[model samples]
Target chain A: MDREEIRVAVLRIEGTNCEEETATSFRNLGVEAEIVHLKQFYSDMIRFEDQRSIFDYHCIVFPGGFSAGDYVRAGAIFSARVKSVLRKDLEEFIKYNYPILGICNGFQILAELGALPGFDEDRPISDRPEMALAINDSGRFECRQTLLRVESRKCVFTKEIEKDKLQIPVAHAEGKVVFPRGREEEYLEKLKENEQLVFRYVDDKGNYSGYPWNPNGSFYNIAGICNVTHTVLGLMPHPERVTFDYRKNSFGDGYYIFKSVISYLEKI
Target chain B: MITFLFCEKLIVFMIADVHIELKEGVADPEGESTLKALRLLGYKRVKKVSSVRVFRIEIDTKSKEEAEKEIKEICERLLANPVIHRYRINWIG
Candidate 1:
């Protein structure tokens, strides 16, 4: 056993609900994965005193769950705490081009923190963040094994993933991608031109259809996106849930994403 | 003028401050309702409509400005969609 395997840190908040599964996924890939509780990382008595800096780990994962009870929207409250405490550390992490993955609720948190698409340098919080995870068009929680087509060749996390579509699972009610009022065209064009859009929903026949084709009704059927440097990734799919071969459905390709993450880390 | 309306006679109204552009491809259900209502009242050429909602919350604070500032965070994170909604507070003296 390689004792000095890649150090993977799974960030856990008070109401966070995906620590165990996230740990298991990384451990299976021969990585040192640990669930670090946010309270333990931060001081008990005051704010920002003992907060765990993102620099402590090689790869940081904001895993899925109902963080902060989704009280003030899905990930707003938790993301605000992270921003307030670890803002400088997060900026350095992004500057150094370290890998950061935000899955499901984490994606929403990342968007709220102005970490996705990477256009929020020194911008006011009142200014709307460029991307959003709106309520699903169907307006219901959907939990099913989903198929995602790898669309971008630039993302480091998806580098080893097959160029073709891969099977994964998506379980969420708010996953639709929305841009600021009049910036839809410009945003989509920039995302596509820069190869930031990493995945899209596609049918088994490889055709981009509707409803299930774009499970959450995201614009451009976008299922995942990465920052310009491809070091930061945010996706709606629950890749950790389907990392094992046994968990695969008859047509599941879930293992590919885990494999991709492992391969990317090894290269780095 | 201050008589209370009975159970079925209650009148409901909402005030909103939407921060959205009337661009194509965006959905405005509230605006659509207003347009339809105006049409029913025999008005014509109601080219466009846009709207928002406001809720006045009273908290214990001497400074109205400070109170508004504090509540804005709650509103942004909870009540209002920062993506398309803007809010201002009005005090009733």
Candidate 2:
């Protein structure tokens, strides 16, 4: 028996459209990946009233898409549903140290659920119960292949890239990660120190500075961030869409993210 | 004829768009539409919304002195992006 086989579960809800690409990416990297629809946990289809425990899987993914049709704000409606309905299961899964990735809409959901940094780990919930992914600095949706500098060395998804920068594609309108007042530099500094600041917007030369080179105009050119534990990561880029050789834009390296995950699983 | 009343002059709401700009190369059509929607929503009373991102701030400061200082810091640090987005302050007590 091949114990080295890694099992990953790509979660699919009604509006989710990236599971196939994400699954394909994982499969191409020699990991056993499966697309599990949210309906499977519940016998009914109309409402997301049913969802089972997610402890069976080693890795879970919340792929990109306009989940819940971006109603009541992007990812807000769907994330509320998930947090309220599957709260216990998700909490348990995290307690066990399971790996989770939220891309785009998924990132929105994670932040809304207080599951990204789980600020409670450091501060009381009363201080700030709600988090926000504000409108882009450009005041618009940015869609194109852009360069991202891998700044964090502690995350599970980005460890294998090793390189200081990665050229990945991004498609989003509300990709800004904003916290309360007076918390910008401190939050970024903490993320940097924790190695949770995984990806940053950069230029062709891998310099993380200036406009046009940095899309969305994230603070400190931030593109992605992970939780304190590194088991959970939330990013603005769509790695699943460009995880194959043919999908690469002008730059041709997108498989390393999946490769890194698989490599970690193999070692385990 | 419309009747107008004057008193000690209470501060009325002043609409301010806390514009946030993406990097020069970044694209943002949604932000454009939002500006359009603001116009369609009958916000024409104000001169030139200019399609910038807007954030509503509610604070209690009896004096304009304290209000200006607090709001400026808020916008500079969190409410607006200093690098890409420039903020215009409007005092509404």
Candidate 3:
């Protein structure tokens, strides 16, 4: 579709701090982007003009934040709220191949909602989340810039990114993506076979490393993943934080994520 | 200053205790940190350290069977993430 027709909803709830940056990045790309409160889609008290439907947008994003204070778990409250209130409509949204991008806490929410590692095509959102973004191995909030190797050829968000690796900032206490207790090996193999794995943490030399390099100690150094169809993607890094070059005002590493999906939408 | 209903049961308040912790094989960073601190404080004999979070919830149902089923569903849906954490529910009279 045309860039003018590409409307993006940078979705947020209270404590979601990145909606402005995410929406600004999209607007910079010449597309229509709005910072939409999650309530606007559900609250009956919202004025008619202020109300929104997920179907009203070409794409929707869950931006990074300590949503709902990250209580109980990083994204549990937010994800449960979404699943309880907007489950049916969200499933329908996925059916249309509209890209859903989740960054940082957003990634945590998607994992909680069973939207990542979504194995079955027939069920875009699983009844139970197949993965979890646990706390960092450091036992403290890790805020640092990490290198990521683009690991998926099928991911719509990164397809236009010609570079094999990108430097993105990650700031969160919980981002260590883990599979079920004993099924780590099995799930890793399935992710590889299905090509749903998106990004892997790497070192300066671009090799998978440990400790500060891997950041949260995510299994297989996995930094991001997507659903089977690649329409949905969830990653720990904040791509919105670095979408433009300050000096040249040119596109940065994260800008291509937005660019690629818009191009994909244009084609489909 | 309030009146009690005559039909109210004398002992009907039900509580379900949910104990959640990381799966056995999963790394417990917080517990590990605590263990390290204990060792530094001269407690060298401490073999290991582990931790769990307990949530006490009041279920509306009076029947034990119904309360058990509802608590299980609650644990599965919201109280705990099955991927990294496992939970055990205990009933309190």
Candidate 4:
């Protein structure tokens, strides 16, 4: 696979605001990236010529933003719509080891879709969600800069990240990742043992911290994770927003996310 | 309005009251915020606050069992997230 042959789809719906930047991030890396509407994949109203399939692209990105106005819980509406319509396709996508990236609300959507913490390769997408992004313990939206330490080499998205820690921005109300009630420790242990935990929130000193440092109070200071197969990934920070700095003429920490996935697709 | 006209009288269909809430031990930020507001308003004795989102759905179904199945699917697939939420459904017509 060549870099020119890699195709990325930045999945979007109403109220999803980060598709443009996300698509630009991929395109900046010299790959064919398109911001595609979810409806175009399954809506009957869509014209035949414009209709598309998940197989059309090598990677699908669920970008950030308040999808479906964050009603009935953030990302619930979007995830439900996706699961109801594209469940089998997405499951197959995961099983095939095609990269799937979700940022912020996209992270919530993937979690809601039961595509994260994919502990079983034979069953990548569970019938019920294995984890969720709940409202911040602060009881309000948290938007700030966060430091994340790469915790897993197993994830495809962070393998090329040159730094051990990345300074990225996080903005969301429901960013606290939680497992089923009372079983958080068990799942955290499993995630650790499997090397699926991709990014852990760190403080200024580069150590796992709490509160504003952790941003959403995510358990185990986790900021991002990948499935067991390392095909599907989700994180709370907006990697697209900080990919490059024009004046500095240098890549930001988030650049490695898009770069890593594209390299993986190209190499494979 | 058209349903009433079709029935000639407002004969009601089955109604479902679905309560969706975070599972026990999960934090409820909205409920906590509400509790904080109440405390500010001088409600001193409030020990705890819990929140539930209740939805009333009306469906035209022939049997209680059938309605139960459909509503359960609706709750599981949309109204509630099984990972962090547990839902209960009550039927009335």
Candidate 5:
């Protein structure tokens, strides 16, 4: 596929606040990216010209935000709406190996949709969620620059970040990644074996630490993860927020994620 | 017996109060903070506090058992995150 033909959709719905910056991140990489409202994809009330098809884009993104007010659990409403309406389209999208990225509340939506911790490679979408991003242990919204150690090179989104660690900002009250109580070890082992684990929260020294360093007290200090195919990714950090190179002493670590996806889309 | 048969013919409305709470081992900062606030207010007897989300769903079904089952399905599928939270259903008709 030609790079000019690559189209990315930064999908959004009511209360989703980060679609603009996320779309801009892809646009910065010289690709066409649009902030597409979820309503435009499924709502009958939307104007005919405003409606969109998931098949039109090569990449889809669920940007961070408190969608539908984050009521009935964070991302529950958004996830349910998508699953109720766009499940087949999304499932087909995944089966086709198109890239899907989720950040913060977007991550929560993916978990709710059972699109991450994808243990069954044959089934790109799970019938039920296997994990969750629960409330932070701190009991309050945590907004800070968190250090993340890149743990997997197999993910298409992180192939360009050769560095062992990245400093990305996270702002959420529900970013703690947790698995089912008794299945933690088994899940971690499988994730490690499949090389699906993408990032782990680490301290400034790149060591797994506790409290504020680990932010939400995520299980095993996990910050991000991808599917077995490495095509679908969900993370609690906002990569788009730090993709600018003009910032002081900026490494623009997040820019590489967009670049990596663009490269993958170009190759296939 | 006649009244009971007639009652069955009438539409029955029920409200299911579903309460969802984080599992015992999961950390709950909101509940903990509320506990701390109570402690600071000199409620020395308070030991622990946990938070739960309550969802009241209205259903129209003739059989209470059927209503319960449907509400349970809703709770399991969408009302709660089974991974970290457990939900209980209480029906009031």
Candidate 6:
């Protein structure tokens, strides 16, 4: 499909504040991107014209923000609502190998929905979440620029970025990625072996550091990851926030992420 | 009519209190901060502190066992994240 033919859906609901920037990122790339409400896809209360089908879009972007107020764990409420209503559509979306990107709170939602570390191939969505994005070790909301080392090129979202490290802004109180206790080592090994590990938080010197350098103190300093299919990706950083051109020196390292998605869709 | 409504309320409403906390190994920053504050206030004997989320859930069930079962499912599926936290359910009749 042509780049223009790529219909990207930047999904949002109440409290999801990043949809506009996410959609604009795709629009800047000359693709048709729309900020779609979760209600539009599932709620019957919406008008016929407003209601939409998930299958209508080629790519779905779950943008950042505290959806449904991030109560009862950051993304649990939103994830449960999605599962209750649109689980089949999401499963089918994953089955067909379309790209799904989740940033920050979106990352938490994907994990809550069992879409990350998607261990079971026959079942893309796990019956229960195997991992979680827990509260920051700092005990407060952290908002700052973070250095991320690109650990893998296997994902459809990060394939175009040739750089070893990129500076992206991370804003969240619950961005610490943790697997279930006792299974951490085994799961980490499996993720490494599968090449599903996407990005790791690092310091300016490119070393895996602790505390503020690692921000929320994510497990293994992991900043992002993908599923076995390499299509569904969940990361804590806000790539959309940096896609603008004003930062000439860094040249918006995140722009390549959207470009990679566009390139991947074009080939399909 | 008032007695009937009161009796009906007694049979219909059941409240379960759930307390959820991060597992022993998982880091608890809020708990740690509370400990720090206590230390600063000269509470030297207080060795540690932990934080927990208390959820009071009202479920419609006739028997206590059914209420417990339903609340347990609710905690497992929504209130608690099994990956990082463990939860206990208490029947508050």
Extract clashing residue pairs from model 5.
Answer: none
> Residue B5 deviation, candidate 4, in Å?
13
Give candidate 4 regions above 4 Å deviation: B1-12
* Cα lDDT listed for each candidate: 0.72, 0.67, 0.89, 0.89, 0.89, 0.90
DockQ, computed on Cα atoms, for candidate 5: 0.73
Q: Candidate 1 has which clashing residue pairs, if any?
A: B16-B52, B16-B53
How do these models rank on DockQ, best leading?
6, 3, 5, 4, 1, 2
How accurately is candidate 4 docked according to DockQ?
Answer: 0.70
TM-score of 5: 0.96
Q: Model 4 reaches what TM-score against the true structure?
A: 0.94
Cα lDDT tens digits, model 5, A66-147, are 9999988899889998988998999889988999999999999999999888877677778778899988998889999999
Selected candidate, larger TM-score, 1 vs 2: 1
Q: After superposing candidate 5, which stretches have Cα over 4 Å from the reference?
A: A249-251, B1-10
Docking class of 4: medium
Task: Give lDDT tens digits, candidate 2, residues A1-268.
Answer: 1324577888877788777888887877667788887655544664554344476567888888888777645676666566556667776766666678888888876776667655344321112223467567676678988888787767878778866767678888777766544566777667767777888888887777755666666667777777777777888888877665555353245677777666665665
Fraction of native Cα-Cα interface contacts (under 8 Å, chains A and B) also present in model 6 = 0.80
Give candidate 1 misplaced runs (Cα > 4 Å).
A1-3, A44-52, A120-128, A247-252, B1-62, B73-81, B88-93
User: lDDT per residue, candidate 6, A26-63, as tens digits?
Assistant: 99999999999898997899999899999999999889
Instruction: State the displacement of the C-alpha of residue B10, model 3, in Å, after optimal TM-score superposition.
Output: 10
Better of 4 and 6 by TM-score: 6
Per-residue alpha-carbon lDDT of candidate 4 for residues B1-93, written as tens digits (9 for 90 to 100)? 113434454433678899998888888988999999999999999978889999999887555788789989988887888878999997655
C-alpha lDDT of residue A233 in model 2? 82
Measured against the true structure, the TM-scores of the candidates, in listed sequence, are 0.77, 0.70, 0.94, 0.94, 0.96, 0.95
C-alpha positional error of residue A14 in candidate 4 after TM-score superposition, expressed in Å: 1.2
CA lDDT for candidate 1: 0.72
lDDT of 5: 0.89
Tens-digit lDDT string for candidate 5 (B33-73): 99999999999999999998898888777678888888878
Task: Write down the C-alpha DockQ for each prediction.
Answer: 0.16, 0.06, 0.78, 0.70, 0.73, 0.80
Best model number under lDDT: 6
